[model samples]
Target: MTDDKIQELIGRCAERDVLAFEQLVRQFQSYAFALAMRLLCNEEEASDAVQESFVRVWKHLDRYDRGRKFTTWLYTIVTNISLDRLRAIKRNRRLFSSRDEDPSIDDIQDERDLHEIHSNEELAGMIRALTDELPLKQRLVFTLRDLQDLSVEEVSEASGMSIGSVKTNLHYARRRIRQRMAEKYNVERLES
Candidate 1:
């Protein structure tokens, strides 16, 4: 939808128009859920985080600044909620363990279709698994900028980080992902 249309929806939403809110939700829900999934590294938690973020957005609709890009504001809300959920889950796990854990392929919900980003199921699984190895900041930067195709400025604004920080995090994220993918490829080659 165009910015003008979204602005109209936001205006209506601020007035408590349920239908307008639904329209906005329908437009953005998939992307928001995708982002949350990448950030939390779990399907169920991502769904919950998106739901909670939308609820918060609904409650604070009147507080939204019309001067800003609505999607950027929406991303900010979703990212904050997902990060909080991630931190809470991590904290609980840390309380019960003495070491950090890496998410395995089994933990990721594979939903890629043949026409989607990656047609190779095995490669898709490897990418998802390797993504979980990044630090939280790096993961968010990589997901927003590279996966979601947001510009550096948009990612910086959405993530509430400086442009330089976003660039730095994205640099580290790409480097780590490349290193992990290469290592995995080498292992599979050797096994064969």
Candidate 2:
């Protein structure tokens, strides 16, 4: 959908037009859900987070600034909600664990061959393991800036991090992931 149209929908939402809000939800729900899934790593939890996020958006529509990119603001809400849910789940898991099960890196299913645009899921388990090993901030920054293809500034804004912090985290995240990839695949990454 066009930005102008989305803004129009937002304006209508601010005016309490339920249909407009529904339209806006329809336009962006898939992207939001995908982001939620990436963060939460579970379909059910991601669904719950996405639903709650839209409700939160509706409740706080008036606080949205028209000058901001709608996607960035929307992503901010989704990321925050998903991270909160993830933290809660992790806390609960640590509190009530029996046998320790290590979810380590493994091989991937090589499907599509993506070019230098960035790596694709050559090995799904390996990629996920590499990502999961990252600290939360680094993981979030790496996913937002690289996987989601958001600009550095956009990721910083959506993640509520300073631009410098975002860059640093992304740098570390990518370097680590690449190192792991090299070990797993025996391909040296050229330093850029």
What RMSD, rounded to one decimal, does every model reach? Answer: 5.1, 4.2
* Runs of candidate 1 exceeding 4 Å displacement: 97-128, 187-192
Model 1 poorest ten-residue lDDT run? 111-120
Error of 1 at 93 (Å): 2.4
Judge candidate 2 against the unseen true structure and give its global Cα lDDT, from 0 to 1. 0.79
Clashes (backbone N, CA, C under 3 Å), per candidate, total: 0, 2
Candidate 1 lDDT score relative to the true structure: 0.79
Q: Mind giving the per-residue lDDT tens digits that candidate 2 earns over 157-189?
A: 889999999999999998988787677656464
TM-score of each predicted structure versus truth: 0.80, 0.84
Write candidate 1's Cα lDDT for 22-56 as tens digits: 99999999988877876776777888999999999
Residue 179 in candidate 2 has what lDDT? Answer: 87
TM-score of 1: 0.80
Clash pairs detected, candidate 1: none
